[model samples]
Target chain A: MSAPDLADLIENLRRFADDRDWGRFHTPKNLAMALTGEVGELVAELQWLTPRESAAVMDDPEAGARVRAEIGDVMIYLTRLADVLGVDLIQAAQEKLADAALRYPAP
Target chain B: MSAPDLADLIENLRRFADDRDWGRFHTPKNLAMALTGEVGELVAELQWLTPRESAAVMDDPEAGARVRAEIGDVMIYLTRLADVLGVDLIQAAQEKLADAALRYPAP
Candidate 1:
């Protein structure tokens, strides 16, 4: 896909969901609960794995899909959540970048 | 302790660290490095736990202290990082709560 207007990316995602008649299924509580569920799934992906294993969990063919899919699911829900709440995630992200720069100033 | 002004709560945490002359130890990169370490520990708290087991991981005395302490460490470092970067974590939190309310409007 052409680079989504970064500014309107969340809006675009919401519109895509709307086009599919999925907005009804995206009630805030449902979205939040879904977000939480995705987090759990992400956690589960690394569970029982040693640190080295956990980091490389993304490289495994079988488990990699599960972990990557869960991350994308979380992002999708987060985008929609931010959209419904009128949060410009990009702006928040940009602000955070600036803040991080200050906090992580080069030595 | 007197209720910390919600606005300056992060600042207060920074002050607490400063009082102990720990600022030198809280360089942003170090704090971020430390934050990631805490996240690893937090994950470790629930690693290999069944869903039920994960939810109650905090109930185990031995593991509970570790989980709680790591969470507290994460929070402390976060507060300090925000302060040094001129971010008002309380404000960010408040904004997030407002966003959540919008996303999760009661049925």
Candidate 2:
């Protein structure tokens, strides 16, 4: 599949959520907390695996599918919450970097 | 000061970079590479600190200042990079969360 811009992907997902009538559940507080919970679940997938083993699971087809699903869930909530708050995730990230450069310009 | 929206924050930073004529240096490749470098530097700060020590440093005035500076740097560059590509950082993050929720769905 072609790599659609993330913005478009997000728009599509938002529509999906809205269709499911799930948008009502996506309050910023709930979405943010859910993001953390999903991260916890992702970490749980490799709780006791050796670093190498954990990495291995990332490549396993079934496990990879699950992981990818988890990742998609996280992204969906993040996009919904961010849209509600009117912040641009990528731009915010770059601003952080720019601030870093100014704070610690090449020494 | 009241927090301006992150979109505004990013726009302002972009202007700052443009003022410095540094936008030329922010090709996605360079920005992404620099982001990794800055993250490495931030990690280097507490490379060997005990978890407790690391936590302490987070609250220490001087170290906190430097850490915040590093974080700001990270945001600035991230914003700059995201803006160039026209992606919204917050929205992207939320999308990730939404995707995660669908993946895990309170299971």
Candidate 3:
């Protein structure tokens, strides 16, 4: 199957919100906050685990599914925030890497 | 300026790793763990805010900058995780919405 596009995902999210009359509640600030909240849930899954143990989280099927769902939650909110703010997630990521390159140049 | 592309961002990250001989440390498991850690940092910024207060987070310039930086961190690690696993983030996001649609049909 073909992969999804960023625009399409944003559109779907927008429509989802519009359908639920959640547009007003989805301003960038609120969306960003919600994004962080979802991220917290994702983080909770790995809390207190040693790096090795954290790395093995997906070894358990149920835990793996939870992680994936949390990832999806984080992604959905993030995409919505970016959309509200008119930030292109991929583009912002590329620019951040460019900035990082300047900070940590090849040795 | 033109927007950045996912493939380009992935390439830049890959090059950054290769330059540091850090490829071995960037396995999918490690990246996923790092992603959650960064997400935790992002969540900390809005930890105690009520919805209204949370929505005003960006109203404080310093806090706004911190929030943005944390967002950048989360994005970078997430992108890296997807790259390591050969998952197309945009596509995966799209498919996720499709699955969500089936679960939460429009009313």
Instruction: Choose the strongest candidate by lDDT.
Output: 3
> What is the Cα-based lDDT of residue A19 in candidate 3?
86
DockQ of each: 0.04, 0.09, 0.35
lDDT of 1 by residue, B4-104 (tens): 33234454555555665667666544544554554455456555666555445545778755544544444444445445544444333334434444675
Q: Which candidate has the highest DockQ of all?
A: 3
Candidate 2: deviation at residue B22, Å? Answer: 2.0
lDDT of 2 by residue, A61-91 (tens): 7865554454455445445545654555555
**Residue A41 C-alpha lDDT in model 1:** 61
Per-candidate Cα lDDT values, in order, are: 0.51, 0.55, 0.72
True contacts kept of 3: 0.34
TM-score of chain B of 1: 0.70
Q: How well is candidate 3 docked (DockQ)?
A: 0.35
Of models 2 and 3, which has the larger DockQ? 3
State in Å the error of residue B105, model 1.
26
Off by over 4 Å in 1: A1-12, A19-25, A103-106, B1-107
Which numbered prediction scores highest in TM-score against the true structure? Answer: 3
Measured over all alpha carbons after superposition, the RMSD of each candidate to the real structure, in angstroms, is 14.0, 11.4, 3.9
